[model samples]
Target: MPVTKLYIDKEVEDYSNVREFSSRIDLEGEIVDDQQVIFDIIQESSDPIQKAKEVIFLTRNKGAFIKKCPGTSIYTCCGYKILHIGTFCDMDCSYCILQTYFHPPIMQYFVNHIDMMTELDRIFEEKAIHRVGTGEFTDSLIWEKWTDIASKLVTKFSKQNNSILELKSKTVNIKKLENLNHNGKTILAWSMNTPHVIKEEEKDTTPLKARLRAAQKVESWGYKLAFHFDPMVFYDNCHEEYKDVVRQIFKNVSPENVAYISIGSFRFMPDLKQIIQKRFKESTLVYGEFIHGLDNKMRYFKPLRLKMYQAIVSEIKLLAPDVLVYFCMEDDEIWEKTFGFVPDKDEGLSKMLDKRVAKLCGLNKGLLI
Candidate 1:
């Protein structure tokens, strides 16, 4: 969390919560006249992308807090809901879409918790099974040093019976969560990768062993867990390394405590390639065997991706076969070839995940439980 500069929204300067959030930080603060200051800072930066992580923005989310995941119809979608808490991350990953998804990616912390609570209250009243998460746009736990955002969301979801909150991050920030009355309504998840990948590609993230140790602590605290082997890169000796990662997972926590596991191959938009090329020229990920997908992103060749996934899925099944395993934004051909059937055919992927949530966390009456 190298927040060298802080930009406070003028409108939120008087709010006590915002004031409290900014009080303990050591960085110098500037009272911005308006949100345009964001664009100005980006335009003025000598290196906008790098400078983006060097600064933090304390602002309000004027838009709706809740949004549907922008899943493509060309694939079998999971239908997960995104709680737009904030955008951008403090950590740097060579394969991160944040570098290209948002121009001049900035670490934004929405100070308006009331707006978030208001939206969540409405969703809880709807009483429909919903799989909601705060990790879509940012590392959900990155703002823990200044804000109790993770604690607040956990407490709120504890009393709800229809929706479960998934806080996914590469960092180990689970201290605030252990004391909260989450009532198994929260899924404490970690993004897993090989030690080689973590050391080479993921910058400033917790080490793999430390992340698993944190998961062990959270599991002991009685929170249901989840893991994502996403952006599963097809690098040198990746198969054995990933298999070892799966073994490490079961070594730390029981399979029954897991809510689900998600696996996704590395896929990114075309423009992101240039950003990686310019920003991380030494990265070999950009030079891998890739083909343009229906969604216009460059993905690994089908057979190659399947080989990598098959190796990983086989390892995971050996350790935790009963744990629900799914892909992130892949098509029917990939799913059918990998699992012998598409999850979309029996019941929608979203429904299956929701049922997992309901069964594991007691969100509602689900057969899986």
Candidate 2:
């Protein structure tokens, strides 16, 4: 039986309101248990909530909120700032790094919202144009089936002006966000893939069609949208498959409504190859033409990456030329070859992304990056 461990800081125990929220989910086949572990370090700990933050809510082998984002690297790039909400995904994907990123992988969520909010408040107070998201470590909406967490985040972020919150996910669980006071400050983004990839590599994820349908619904509700084509798997007939995905996207939602679209070829840590071999033997993505990048990560050789990038960029430009398009973590040479410019030429990638997000969210200038 899968079990969910609930950790509550003594400070917010009375106001945590976790039980009230958990009761709303129709959980089945999992042995759910609740415990109150007294946190003594909150009194003098620089970030007492840090410890509570570490006591991740896990199911079996899954973990949550493992580490802060390490600085000084641009390869594992997402322009937005990260909000490390939880780790491990409930839905399994053959090429997922989380399987190896976390040992004995289990689904875990951090219940230490008080500390999280405290940290966020500090960042938000900077009033810099910043875009932040919580989907990096896990699928953002997977927990929506059982928790109203996204809704709460929407409600919280709606009150902030400087930062735009992006909730990226493969799931179409936007019900929690439908009626929230979003203020257009939250960008509901989706990590998209070709239907072929969805059907073959991604397991238990929302169908590609259903995901776009949901994006259309959200756009109709006056929310800015974003899409990601990360891990653009290279396979026979992959170009046609990906082109079809781009077409389907514009059919469902206008490019004008999109804030940005990110295109990244498949890349992974060298260690992840071993994990995929041991756990997901059927996945051929690991066996593709790859080379060790300067950052020591295994990525598609430059030519292959440029090929995929140019193809996707051309297709997306046809549909939405003005929408911001950028690669996930490619460096100067690849950026110039693919996008015609480099990050530093535009005051760095992070700043450029901050401006794009700020403009889309109607935030004041110079608020992030």
Q: Best candidate per TM-score, number?
A: 1
Q: State the RMSD for candidate 2.
A: 6.9
Misplaced by over 4 Å in model 2 are 1-16, 21-79, 345-347, 366-369
Report the lDDT of model 1 for residue 85.
87
How accurate locally is residue 44 in candidate 1, as Cα lDDT from 0 to 100? 92
Give the TM-score (vs. native) of candidate 1: 0.97
Each prediction's total of clashing residue pairs, residues at least 3 apart in sequence or on different chains, is 0, 9
Maximum-lDDT candidate: 1
Quickly count the clashes in candidate 1: 0
Candidate 1 lDDT over residue span 1-369, tens digit each:
477888888888877767777786776678898767786787698767888887888889999889998988887777788999888988889889988878657777887889899999999888478889999999989878888889989999999798989999999988888778889999999999999989888988999999999999999999999999998988879999999999999999999999999999999999888888888877888898789999999999999889988998998889998999999888898898888888755447888898878989997763332
lDDT, candidate 2, 201-256, per-residue tens: 88778899999999999998888999999889988888778888999999999887
**What's the TM-score of each model vs. the native?**
0.97, 0.83
